[model samples]
Target chain A: MTKQDTRPRPKAGPAEPDRPQRRKAAAAYPYAFYLPAGIVYVVIFLIPTVMAFYFSLTRWTLFDSTFVGLENFADFFAEQNLSIGFRNTLVYAVLTSGLKVVLGMLLGVLLTSRLRLRGFLRSVVFFPVLVSTVAVGITFSVLLKPDTGLVDRALALVGVSGHDWLGDATTALLSVALVDVWKGVGLATVIYIAGILSIPPDYYQAVEVDGGTAWHRFRHVTLPLSRPATYSVIILSFIGGLRSFDLIWTMTRGGPGFTSDVIASIIYKQYQAGFYGLSTAGNVMLFLVVSAIVIPLSWFLGRREIA
Target chain B: MRTFRRVTAEVVALVVAGVVFLIPFSFMLLTAVKDSVQAAELDFSWPTSWPIVANIAEVVSARDYVLLRAYLNTTVLTVGSVAITVVFAAMAAFVLQRRAGRIGALANFLVLSGLIIPPAIVPTIWLLQALGLFKTMPGLILVEVAFGLSFAVLLFRAFIAGIPRELDEAAMIDGCTGLSLFFRVIFPLLRPVTITVILTMSVTVFNDFVNPLYFLPGDENATVQVTLYNFQSQYSTEWNLLFMDIVLITIPPLLAFVFFNRKIVAGMTAGAVKG
Candidate 1:
């Protein structure tokens, strides 16, 4: 009986098997089914991305073209605003991402607490995210207008005059950055909501039973558990801030003598000025800068996940 | 004593946060119904009279009814782009995840590249022209679809991971082929996430300004956001109509949230919450 049971079943052989055939059949659907999407992925995305690299090396407009290797890239770095654009992109990315994470965590805690009118409060906080960037920019521009705007009138009520929020070169970028934060922090908040909500009740209960203070509970249990959400908030918000354009454009059009010009707006300005090749090079640089920063950062974050 | 102190602190914190976010929006609504001088003054006081109807009418009838056309264009663009993006992305993600090999890795990377890289506008322009789609609605639709596909794919892949593999096997045993199997079996299971993707993508495409500004530059192709320029002239700004324009463009998405804010947040964080 033991010898008979140890013998290989005839049904398990390559031709005679149910399991092997099913496994092979499972494998077949992948390639055959994935083919159409794969073809589209190549034609629409891959081909164009490769072509962009090539075009950055050429001088061209809507209809004109000529090969000019490295000249476009050279011109891009030499522009007066190029360095400023790079500096502003990094600065905005850091400021916006840093602030959003801190605020999001704070709000996440507050809203998730047994607070009053939680539903209404959450909607109010997330309200800015729904409005169009163009509309938001325009509304803020009017509201923050130095003399006639509400900000100034309110300041006047306090015996202080409002400063030129969007007019002065110094304040323009800062103003835009603030609005970006306002429009965006909802995303971080929502992420934090999910993260915090998922924490098992027993963890909190255990902390409380151990005579944990609110601070102690937050420090050990809430903070550690929400690391993934925090990481995501930092990465997504930072990347978004790096590529910000619409709000900046609608607010000031990178004006006040180009003080507010981000890389995207600078590229658009170059395009407007008929320097197509240079603009293309700027696009390439923007792509490289974001990729270089984000890929490494994601890898760093991913390592934290595994550990 | 500690509990009392904590409650006081919480109340103060909540009020401060609420005021900081609320005041700007309050001013916006206030200005929307004010006359030009009053609007420019930025007073937070109630309107001297109700100009809501009058101001909105002016905005609607501005630039030879341009805002109406923009509304139509944006509706078409948003509906078209979201429809294409959700279907294509869902299908691609399903295939990519089901298959595990070089092609899968390459597709995943290609999609990932979109997340980090800014679009190469010049090349995209050229590509559209090369395909004879430049300055066309179809061109804009394709552009939106290409850019949007990656995020949609990411969302779909993450959500699909939660579904059990046994369903696929059970369906295959019932004699369903490729499209039928996906549409009949897999697709229905994906409805919750698909709704989320649809809502988020619709909001994104509808709110998009730059893509429409560049790719669809002509007056006939103007989206509602682009129509803000109708009040903006090189010579002088029309403050009243412009403010009204801003208010008008804001209504749809604002209304969307009024109805579906909770669902949107839930949908948005579905994967993040799980992972």
Candidate 2:
């Protein structure tokens, strides 16, 4: 009986239908579906990236070129403001991302709670995300002007005198970083809200059953579980802050004699100065700095996520 | 009593956040209608007389109606880029999800890296020059689509995983093949993700500054953000007109967000969380 069953199963498996149709469809589709996007990505993104590496080694204007090995990199590093730009970039990125994480999580928790006018409030917070960054920079620059700006005037009402917000060397970078946080925290909050919502209710219920108060529940459940969102918020904002140019360019233009120059603005200044090779090197360096920080951070978070 | 305290606390928090967020925008709007004198004062005092229509007209007519031209150019750029990104990303996503192989895995890595790595602008300009697309509208369009494709493809791939393979097989059994099968059967089912991509990408491309600054430099090809340069010069103090320009350029995307607020939030968060 066993031998007869095995013989019949082999025949049925060999003669099973639909395999030919599936194979035909597979053959027809091939991998050409990836062609359109693949072509665009390769031409516009991938090739430029590969060329960036090569071009950074060559001293080239728009119409001329000469190979200069690592001289551009040396010159980029040796520039008078390079060290300040590097330092400012780190400070700006850290300040913005750190504030964004804390503020975003706070707002997210509040908005996700049983609050009044939650939807309207969320919209209000997120409205800035839609505004153009350049516009935001300009508006804030106007508002934050030393004395005549609305911000200072409003401060005067409360008996606090306003100083140069974006003009003074001391406050320029920090001021821009604060605006960055304001414009970006909305996104961070949205992400955190999504993360908080995704947490299963059972965890909270379990905490309650164990006599955990709201604080305790949040401390033990929400905070730990929202790790993924926090990771993303930090990485996204950090990268954004590192690559920040438009706001700085529009707001300060590395004002007060190069006090607020981040790496990107520095690169743009080089490009404006016709140091194409040096700017390309700066771009590569910025790329390296971002990836070096973000990749490992992501890996660490990912491993923790699985664990 | 505890519940009352909690409620009051929540209300306080909400109001504070609302004020912080809304004040900048409200001030922008207020200044938009103010006269040049009132704008120079830069105080919170309400405009004594609203000249909103006049301000709009002036901004519209400034520099040979450059703002209107910018609006047209931006609309073209946004629509064209979003359309290309959606179609190409959807097709690529469908194949990447359905067809698992070595090449697909490499493609996946490339897409992911595109999200992390910064675009090298100088070389990109060079390549565009080589292709005779530098300083051209079509070049800028291609740049937008390329930069946006990674996020769209990632979102589509996540959404597509929930769709069972049996649907493809079932469609194929009914004589649907290749483009017909995708367009007829599968594409219709991807409407939610499609809307998400469209709305999100449209807002992003429309609001983008750097790409247009680098790739499309001519005044004739100015996007809305680029037109900010018109109002702002090295030593000009046209705060009123500049604020008016801000209000005008901001209206379309701002209105889009207000109307589709829920979908935009959902779509944006969905991409981030899933990614």
Best by TM-score: 2
Please give the distance, in angstroms, between residue A142's alpha carbon in candidate 1 and its true position after superposition: 1.4
Scored against the native two-chain complex, candidate 2 gets a DockQ of: 0.72
lDDT of 2 by residue, A83-138 (tens): 68888989999999999999999888888987878888888888888888988999
TM-score of chain A of each: 0.88, 0.89
The parts of candidate 1 lying over 4 Å away from their true place are A1-41, B229-238, B273-275
The per-residue C-alpha lDDT of model 2 at residue A306 equals 89
Poorly placed runs, candidate 2 (over 4 Å): A1-25
Fraction of the true interface contacts (Cα pairs closer than 8 Å across chains) found in each model: 0.53, 0.72
lDDT of candidate 1 over B1-275, digit per residue (tens)? 97788688678867876667888777667777887666644567787766778888888876688889999999999998888788888888887777666778988888788777788887777778888988999889888888888888888888788888778778877877678878898888899889888888888888998899878998978998788854655203446567677777888888888777777887667655544
Model 1 residue pairs with clashes = A148-B41
Residue-level lDDT tens digits of model 1 in A108-211 = 88788877666777777888887888878877887778887767776888999778899999989988998898888888888998899889999999999999
